[model samples]
Target: METNTQTDQVTNYVYIHVPFCLRKCSYCSFFSVNFSQEASSRFVKYLIKEINLFKQKYNIKPKTIYFGGGTPSLLTAAQINLIISQFDIAETEEITLECNPVNITNEFAKELTLTQINRISLGAQSFLDKELKVLGRLHKADEIRNAYKLLRAYRYNNISLDLIYGLPNQTKEDVEFSLDEIIKLEPEHISTYCLSLEKDVPLFSKIDQIPADEKVAEFYYLIRNKLISAEFEHYEISNFAKSGFESNHNLCYWNDKYYLGFGPSASGYLDFNSKTVCHPERSRRRDHLIRYNNSVNFEIYHKMLDEKKIMIDKIILNNDDHEKEYIFLGLRKAAGLNLEEFENKFKTDFTKKYDKVLHKFNNLLEINERTIKLKSEAYFISNEIFSEFM
Candidate 1:
């Protein structure tokens, strides 16, 4: 275990990664795996031990506790409680748990409600059976409705539904239909993602059958217009929330706030004074999360979590990188980047640095007094515009 400090001196958020799944997705590639109950049990014990070390090192209670994962729903409510009991989170803190429809039951939802788990992120990739099969999802279309009904019956209001577009053989009508059902459900939040042909995934092998980039872009615009017209806030590129339901955990990542991640393949970030580590990478999937372990492989992760360690394995950001990170991450939000806030974090004039990139990409990006936005047309080409920062 190691210790670090942020210049801000604030302890705000913590993330718990549950890298266990009933089964892995064909298109998915994150740290997770199928495992036995005994293994899952051991992993929980290890998580608590690791967290205790973190608490001692950081010396603060996290205001937000997020359980993100391969499939947090795989754990029984009792197991969830046991893992959470180890943390000293504030009573009013936001606690979230991610689940798939297949594991969501009335009993499960009820137990979660009683366990201080206020937020539920449902992996309802699509309500269509065909899409589910193509995506290698285990849940059926009916399962999705049942899952939501169960949550709603438990009086759970802070719910988020995930949607995926650009699937193979999917049509515009398919995307619209899914969105229509989502709008009718009126979930507090919706996270829309375009499928990426990630390396080594089963879905990546059938790349030729997937929707073309142009068609995928069309659906992207469709989602934005539909969600906006339905009164959802396009708070981030991939997230749409109703006013107050924006994801606090994800915000930590985009805003570069300090957070601790527990469980295998999970990465923790602590701000230690002037310098910081932005993104951390993992090589193995979190199989033991399903079956709890005594401890995560700390030595492997120490390099990434070490205080003020330079962000390597990808492009390193200088002052240009910082300015670009602010713009890139900031534009993903509806409020956009606060210029004053940007200047404060990077200690550089935004207009003075990367003026060429900003100027050349002006049509694609909208620079307001307090915020920078991607024009409606640029949302599809957002990656290209953001690449300028890189």
Candidate 2:
């Protein structure tokens, strides 16, 4: 891991987590509690405290701010504005708020325009109400349409719609219907996720109902081709966007840049001079790069902040860890990983170090003079390919 010795530089990206939802989705595994006015108000106060604590530690001039959540839309426009006021944001900066369709009322959209928020990511998981019911979403199919119209009426040009594929008993026509609606709406960006039945999620009980692996792959390719044909760039594994509208905040993550995360369960990565030793067995030498996660328990989070103590699990990254992360994270982008840049960063020849794994997955990967990437057709099995590096 390279040491960033400069202490004057500002961390330009920030992620604020709002961990309260009206209802937890059946497939969600993220940390969130049922929404309550009193609890949410209290959470906001503590969230501001957490932000202030970090402000004292780093010089943060945010270029991109992302409010992700249990449902960020649940926050009042004033609450959202209070959070944004903490940063020195420019008009050109991209500030995105993820919203549940049901929460985007006309009045809410009007108030949002008064804030610094420039982008909206609407959670429209499916165009069919039946699928939404199956996934335990609070809104109906019509609400998604109404929400988009409402946002547009308030002059929100940068909007991203989310879609989920490979639902139980989902068919080709089902996907086509959803795709047709999405294309017609012409959102500035689109994110598509394939349903994964994690054991901890309520949806896991119906694991057998999921489509076969082969069918899921077909759905993936179908989505890719449709979005591409609609003039959207397939920029990342699960994201597509119109040119110049690709998510700058998400791009920061994929490009391996430093970012700050605030609120409970939020995680952050930074490169700085520190005396912390990650591997005491190897040497007592300081590690410069570290990733830390705030406590998931809300009570502990508030208590630590109240006591002016940082409650985080921190991991110092060594060269090997950094190299693996760079490969996996960089490969998630459609542009792939640049071999020259990798060698420059790690002081290792890419071809020489992983020659065996490279040859093993030769046909699935695209290797050129300067870059290496998975072929588009092989994206469905990217996890299997990434495991070789692990």
- TM-score for each of the candidates: 0.86, 0.95
Cα lDDT, all candidates? 0.75, 0.89
- Native RMSD of candidate 2 (Å): 3.1
- Candidate 1 — worst ten consecutive residues by lDDT sum? 285-294
Residue 231 in model 2: lDDT: 99
Best by TM-score: 2
Per-residue alpha-carbon lDDT of candidate 1 for residues 263-339, written as tens digits (9 for 90 to 100): 77666554332222322321131111111121345344344333322222222334454455557787777666778
**Candidate 2 per-residue lDDT over residues 1-390, each given as its tens digit:** 212222564899999999999988999988889999999899889988878777766678888999998899999999999999988776338999999999999999999999989999999989999999999999999999999999999999999999999999899889889989999998999999999867999988888888899998999999999999999999999999999999999999999999989988999988743323234444543345789898889888988888875526788787788889999999999999999999898889998999999999999899998999989987999999898998
CA error at residue 370 for candidate 1, angstroms? 2.6
Best by lDDT: 2
Clashes, model 2:
0
List candidate 1 segments past 4 Å from native. 1-9, 273-323
